[model samples]
Target chain A: MRDGEPLVRWAWIGDHVDELAHYTGVHLRLGLLPVLLGLLISIPLGILCHRWRWAYPPTLTAANILYSIPSLALFMIFVRYTGLTERTVMIPLTLYTLSVLIPNVVDGLAAVPDPVRQAATAMGFSTVRRVVQVELPIAVPVVVAGVRVAAVSSISLVAVGQLIGQGGLGYYITRGLQLDFPTPIITATVLIMLLALVTDALLVLAQRLLTPWARGKGAAA
Target chain B: MNGFLNQLSLVGDWLTSSQQWHGPDGIPHRLLEHLTYSGLSLLFAALIGLSLGLLVGHTGRGAFAVASVANLARAVPTFGLVVLVVTLAGLSTAPVLVALTALAVPPILINTFEGIRGVDPDARDAARGMGMTGWEVLLKAEVPMALPLILLGLRVAAIQVVATATVAAYPGLGGLGRFIVDGLARNDYELVIGGSAVVVLLALVVQAVFTALRRVVVSPGLRAPASGP
Candidate 1:
């Protein structure tokens, strides 16, 4: 009877949606916090380099070098110090995000027509105001694209965190494999794909929501 | 880091053990027995994928069906699917090869079909007007233009095989993944890092080799369009 419990998977998803939501929310927070941190750090870094030409290649190099560190190896490095808490997950994942996010953000900002910035400056817009009103708004779509990539990568990386015993859906996959329960393993695996799809869809919707100007441009075009 | 230096030395040390390399382990002899498993599977898949894609493109009506099948297969996580295959097929190199090849076929199939579909219509018309047979037109006109996209599919398959060939470790054929899994078990970070480094290096090397081959085989005009818009 007790053995049957393992096979008796329920529609607990309905009653337990909140708990699942919490799990996904934490995982997203874990994944996105670093992305958020990375964006905060690297976008400004990217902007500065974009504003000043010399910092581009070297800043870009730092991100590339960081990216080549494979996710599992990175998780190991984090484990050596932090012993597999959220910090361990965030640090390497954040570092990884800088590579993907910075280049896009910088590219988007650079894609801003030179005339627009010059015209903003000529209009006596303060440097900060020019960047705020002119640059970020124009670069929003590309930055959002970068955010999409980071979101996907980080959600996938959440599985690695489960390797160290974190309790996301990855825990279900890893734990089931260990115990020889394919049901849980398959369920968890499907859950992960679902989670990733949901994250991607949310990001897409968020991009549309945040960039009303894109819709306006689409309409006019 | 010192850790990095230590790994380089270990690789250097292992390279010296010829027996292990040729036979099993402790050597860097590039064992053919294990290498052929992945190679043959990829070869088999590419052959099937190309044939199916060609049939679909020439037929055209069944494309939506093929696309749905490829999408469904590709959606399965390589790790989970491999595990499922192994459980069903019994633990051995067979399941690993099947899983990798199945995983490989979709990309190649999709690319080849799209590539053939994208062959310029005017070019096809001109070839026909020039007194070419249907087969002659396809061979001389369509395949030549589609070669780069076909090669790109093969390249993706090659990289995927290189990475996924590691997953064969669980079934006991002992690719780079064996080192990673063992390293994880032993808490030897160096082994995991070293193993991954090798896999990454292998992938990069394969990519470079294919890229160079693409330059040699693909015609200049076709190459540019086949590669990008």
Candidate 2:
């Protein structure tokens, strides 16, 4: 909108750079915070479920159903109950991540090779120590992959949060599409892609470091 | 006048329809249309993505580069791509089709690339020994071995796209997302719930289709080279 601003280009990116920066941080924080919380709670929950067969189905089912909930619909539900804002976004997203990641954590922990668990049990290792040392290590790769998936899903879905008055990179996207201004919309689209790529790269780095023994290629494992 | 009354179901039509329990937006025909919109976008994405992916997966250096770039492409947000496509193609079907196909492409590309790459070198050598050319070996050997994994990738991509096509309503193409978006605008709870039911069903149907398709291509013995997803 300013004089000397280039039209038909992402030049608006510079003018709105601060708004974009402010919102991008908000977006990442909102996206990653729930994942961290999900990881913390689910790791123990997964182990407890693994240790107790009775706890398996319900814990797993709850999250699986949540995973199946469409983001747009779920976000609308949050909007109605919570009113529109990042808070609304955060709540549904946190719930959603738990559904996917918790189950993965549980399964990953359960999949710790029987021989390794047997050896630990035969060595008279304490249940807690055995879990913290052996099972947790083996499960980290799968759990991280789940976390990566959650992170990616949240960042993209959070764009919906823009409609609720949250000023994330999604701000430009929502406005741009509605206002017929390609500048903001395309800029926002490219920015989200860059954000996704960077986040994915970070996950890849984390995965490579966490699972040195995993021979499977790429960030997939 | 008599025919009009007959077509109106003697004024009792409302009682049997889902409108009372599920709301006005929950009518079966409307739900089917929503499914059709989402389903078609996914179908387009799969057909386009798998074709382009297979091409890149089996070809030379440029193909490899395209496949690698697709990894980053998958990371690109679907909502963002919608915005981009809307900017480039406007609010009609083109943007949505382009966006959904872009969303589907990366997984198909990566899976097919990896699947082909993962083909046994010894198998290629065996094919060549049998007087097969490079393309011959690729069709007869590489595709079959890699088909299962590639299909898995395509399956996952299909599932993701089914959910994502709902995002297209933001750019003006209504699918199940229409109910959610329009309902949100009007605070129509029934519409929201009814709309979500359609999305859930769409996801399930896509799941079922992929599961049945997987049964066809998954066996190790089914690794026929010319068989493409």
Candidate 3:
């Protein structure tokens, strides 16, 4: 707006480097941990559903209903029980991940071909070993795609936690709006987008590494 | 135990008060503001997104490009965009409309595109064989067939916009979210919870209305398979 003051001021970030780092750390945790927790819960639950046909339909329906709940309502409702602590934020964030992840986990397991299961069985693989060694590995790409969506969505939702005073980059957003400053708002938005892209790329890398068979054998010159 | 009871009573009192329903500060007014913001944003988003999506789907070109942009847009936080717009444009309804519109666009666009793309090729061929023009085939044949998924997209977009538009109150604007933002600042947990209850109720009602409408609008033959979880 001024001669030297751009919408996003690099100098302001330089001046508040320590606070920026802290906020960035908070943002990363708020974004990443919930999705990780969801994945942890989903893998076993998804496997059980895959093993037992009866569980899949009900579980899928429940997840969809849960997904429909507004994130703000979910975040705020927990305040009564959890107080203003980080758990209030983490619990809903973690639970929300289940709605998106469970469906994806089930879809991933479903993507596994029937012949692959029979092949593993014929090879004398036990149920647990076959699932771990064969089905789960083949399911990684589909599951990872879901993970990417969950991760990105969680990151966006985490910003909403600022209303409760727990948001990381969200602090800058609220603070900026309150002060009517353009710099922090612009900077945080850019950083959050970059964070999403980085997280997506990392997940893609994880998918590639986990499923080496899916990759082309070293390309030649 | 006592604190929870007090909160409940507080919320009860707030909801029961005739004063809360009377002025611009009233729940009714705030609800009106919230719906107006969400509704207008949805309309604008649907107009732009549906048209582009229809063109992309019917032409079968730029599908990859649209998908890439939609996926990228998914990562952009609504709060960040709202704040950025407010700072640039100053505090007004503009920020809320712009931010919620951004939120509503991708799903509608993606769904409309997919709905059109997913129309049975045989049906498209049959329409062509019947000597229909491209416009006639698209309007009569494809659009009708794709209506269910397109409606599904609109339902998703509308619910999301309604929920998120509450944040408009955070920037000193009036919406149901005003209760939460103001209450939190003043340590009025009851007001916060009361506001959230209304938001949750609104969300569920919107979902139910859409679900019911889907049953009415979608051909009964299409309903069975389109019942996506």
Candidate 4:
């Protein structure tokens, strides 16, 4: 047999476009599900804590403890119960997102200026209307900031699922390592970084669109 | 439920084994390797992050640039980076160290910059009025005031490195993770569980130690004042 291929070849990336697309789809799915799950759980929890006041510290402490658990260990520990399926991979990723997002949600809501909140109340808006209409609009930027961090982190971590034979761009990294072929590994690494950077840029753009009032202030500065 | 109990019992059994506790391939040796990898990486990251952060904070320039770059780097997957580096560098400690150092830098750098930037302007004015040089004002007044947050950055980086260094096992380096990988390969689920427990424990201990260090190092005056009735 001929000697093995070089560590990285641009031609191989072109040749494997279909396979790369499939893995990119898998990567996005795996990364995104956790962010959605975390947001689903944390938003209501954050709202509850924000309203109650007493619940915030303990809840945040618990989230911190959960965050400190190594993601790899958390993934393996779940394998016993989840049986090496996507559930095993997802449960840990979702928990990590919650750990990052809850505090941001709470802090964002807390940041609503007292006068603005009171002004909404004086206008005879119901509590739910005030929250959804007035408070949430102001809090969106901060909450979105948290989501941006969580989303990028989840995307990076989805690659770790390769250890348990889960999909994502990590497939190439593991496969290349096993075969000692550089092309797939290097190609996947660059692709994963690109995915992360592109997603981050999109989030920044979304934030700008959502908070148009800030544009005027920014220009003034 | 049964599987959970079984894993717990298996881990307990594995930990009780004196053989696993001592010798060349034992827990102590593995723990030492894990700590060494984490410590060296954190040290290197601190050196790079702190100096650059200080320069950025002092000059009041490049703060935004440094932060944007750090945020992007933070988004790079650590596992992928480690494997990629190892494939290029061969199966030595370099890849793990390099990857983990990259992982550790952002928090330290960001925190140092923020901490120094947050220093009280009044205190800075006082230092300047006392005829201190720019370097002296930064070293004496600004850094000390920023110590709490700077240490906070170090703590964050250190804990992250400790938790992440376990992946070094993949590249043929010895660490607490060896037990997890080896056990999984051998179908020894107990060893895997036990190894994970050790890693989680190490992370918690590191966090607690840093919390204690913060209390000791941060001046009492700088701490939040006690609430009075």
Candidate 5:
């Protein structure tokens, strides 16, 4: 940002359109993959915690400790094993999601009304079937609420991976800083924020579609 | 397995070496810088977030707006904010501080508002029944009742700030993150690992301090049952 240079050079964006699109794809991959993986891991872990109340406190404490470690630090720590690759970034991000996802999953399951559970049990549904078909469906709204938070945070955090040479849009931010230019920095920042918001909106829409019954009852979680 | 142990020992050696502890660029000075950045950002964030949260929560107004704004804030990337601020303003600690404070505010504000809002109506009524005014009721009854949540919010904010202030080093500002950023540039894995280890430790210490603070500050009667064995 020099005295005479414009804050954002429109011409630069025009030239970097392909590059921007490439990074957007990379950014989405870096950000969303961990969330997908985390959801897979959290569901079972959440079920376990919900089933055995004793498991929750320790699980939650471990997740909180993992969550508190900064993204950069975690990235560096993982680099020891994973090298300077996408795995280094995704592994930490996946661990980070547990803190948010596990709680939400457990809460979503817990929100199932007792009578609803009893009714499911009475209807000749097997234990596994009842949990899968009845309980989980009821839990969709709450689970999706957690997913929305996890997705947005994961997306934003993906940019910090740039410090370790893997951040999606974060690359441009650091590049812009090193080059003493503002256009890429502003552009990347806007895109990352846009990506987060858009992902969040999509999750909310998905929640609505998944739990049509919950539509007019106010926001999830 | 061997490589992992080797790296661990490397990190241990880096930590134990006395030379790493003595200079202006050493661990002690960097730790101090890290703490200063974290403390200052937390102070500003607490001031702004706490005051606004208290006002909104006590009045039972603007809860929705505060929550939406806080959630939106959470979506902003700390790295982007740091570079954007530094690129807009010149390279100085000011930009770093601004970014760090922005990162920390949302958690504190939302938690405080939620805490105060969650206070029992019966408690408020009892305070009024005791002839306390609005401010007195808020201070004496609502705040004390909300202390746990408010403290939780502060703890969250403190940990976040401690973590993010590391990014302050990206703009050539000094802190523990200086090691990670500079270490990567120099291909110094030892420095990177050691710096990251210290940061994780610091964050844990902050978490522990807050947990202990909660036990001391929050009255036993007001403390939630789940917090106890």
Candidate 6:
């Protein structure tokens, strides 16, 4: 948008390939590590809520409240304790994931038909074993659905971390803005979108491979 | 624990200072700007998303297109879009509004489509059997039934817009985000903390308002019993 400046200069991209690649890698890690950590935390917590019943409402309320906080505000709040480290960014992102992941995990588990659960019990399988080996498999499609949403959202949000100086691809976006340039902004945005879409597609594929039996159930729920 | 209390007090002091309350950049003025940006964007998003969702959901045609667009929209980063648009259009409120509306649309559209599409077939058929036209069935039977989810969609969109409207400040627009962004630039941690607290409070108030609206607007008969997540 500056005079004589093309929307994107391929020569600039070619020159900055190494820099772009580094940011891309950082972007993936910043965007995804929290999702992976969230899954670890959410699965057990979701199961607890599912089994106890009483815990779900308060737990959901807490997560929803946390989710409502803006990403930048959450980042700044955490900066008080976490300093300027990546932890500041990841902490809020992980918390945000809980609102999406827990419900999906619960719903996925609840989707297990009573008769199927009865059969699992009648077959003398222990509760833990039934949950892990029998129930979790049935829950994959639904949980994956939540994961897909969380992953894309997390990836997109990682850029907002730039305000605190931790934004991955977001750095280029801000840089482009400050310098009144469009190439980096456009390039970074495209890459972030691609990362989200690719990650979502991979999750869909993983769901298919994991739940071949659900082929008859039609496209993802 | 002491440090936490210290920070809280700092934020409180910042919030209460008389100097912070009166001027062009005052809290009240910025808060109004934030609300205006959020309100305008939400209105536009609702108009576009609701109408498109109704058309696609009613006919069952273009469902795939709607789903794909929603999914793709989810992947687009709000910050990136804002910066990208600003860089292209130069600094102005219009680009920011465009970006915020774009960010808010997918949820409303998807939820509206799904809510309508998910209406019980029996109810739809019953409406038709009673000599209702296509429009009548959609309006009388389908939309009323889908009211809860449609309201839910609006609520989600509203909250999201209010939060992202903070980023609209990055393009030199005035809003609550001015405090955070300016605070960061000037290394005023107290101001940053105070500003973030206000934004969080505003979001909560918005959430509460939507919850109250849902209670009033959604029919009690259609309301599902309070259930665990």
Scored by DockQ, the top model is 6
Better of 1 and 2 by DockQ: 2
Candidate 4 lDDT over B183-204, as tens digits, reads 7779877788899988888888
Best-fitting candidate, scored by TM-score: 6
Per-residue lDDT of candidate 6, residues A40-99 (tens digit): 999999899889988987898788778878888889888999898888999999999998
DockQ ranking, high to low: 6, 5, 3, 4, 2, 1
The digit string of per-residue lDDT tens for model 4 on A1-221 reads: 01665667888889999989999999998888999999999889988878998887678766766777787788889988888788888888898887668878887899899999999999999998998888878888878888888888888888888878784998998887777677888888788888888897898888888888877676211
lDDT of 3 by residue, B1-229 (tens): 8866866787788789788788887899998998899889999999989999999999999999989888888788887887677677766897668889988999899989999999999999999999999999999899988989898789878867876787767776678888888888898877888887777778777777877888788777676432232
Better of 2 and 6 by lDDT: 6
User: What residue runs in model 1 are displaced by over 4 Å at the alpha carbon?
Assistant: A1-168, A210-221, B1-3, B10-23, B27-34, B55-75, B128-137, B168-173, B222-229
Q: Considering DockQ, which of the candidate structures 3 and 6 is the better prediction for this target? A: 6
- Of the true contacts between chains A and B, what fraction does model 5 have? 0.65
The lDDT ranking, best first, is 6, 5, 4, 3, 2, 1
Off by over 4 Å in 2: A1-11, A45-68, A85-87, A95-124, A204-221, B1-36, B52-67, B118-148, B212-217, B220-229
Interface RMSD of each: 5.7, 7.9, 2.5, 5.9, 3.3, 2.4
lDDT score of residue B153 within candidate 6: 79
Question: CA lDDT of B41 in candidate 1?
Answer: 74
Ranking by TM-score: 6, 5, 4, 3, 2, 1
What are the lDDT scores of the predictions, listed in order? 0.67, 0.69, 0.81, 0.82, 0.88, 0.89
Q: For candidate 2, what is the DockQ-based docking class?
A: acceptable
Clashing pairs in 4: A7-A182
lDDT of 5 by residue, A1-221 (tens): 77898988999999999999999999999999999999999999989988999899889888888888988999998898888899999999999888889988898899999999999999999988998999999989878878888889899989888887899999999999989999999999889889999999899888789987777888565
Candidate 2 residue B129 Cα shift, in angstroms, is: 8.0
Better of 2 and 3 by lDDT: 3
Instruction: Point out the worst 10-residue segment of candidate 6 chain A by lDDT.
Output: A212-221
Q: Taking the tens digit of each residue's C-alpha lDDT, what string does model 1 give over A1-221?
A: 12444542566445656766676677667767887898898778878977887777667655655554545545655565677587877888788778768777777898889999999999999999998899988887888778766766566556556655553665655555556556555665576666666766777788788778778566211
Least lDDT summed over 10 consecutive residues: which range in candidate 1 chain A? A1-10
Interface RMSD of 4: 5.9
Model 3 - which docking category? medium
Give me candidate 6's interface root-mean-square deviation. 2.4
* Per-candidate DockQ vs. reference: 0.17, 0.31, 0.52, 0.42, 0.56, 0.63
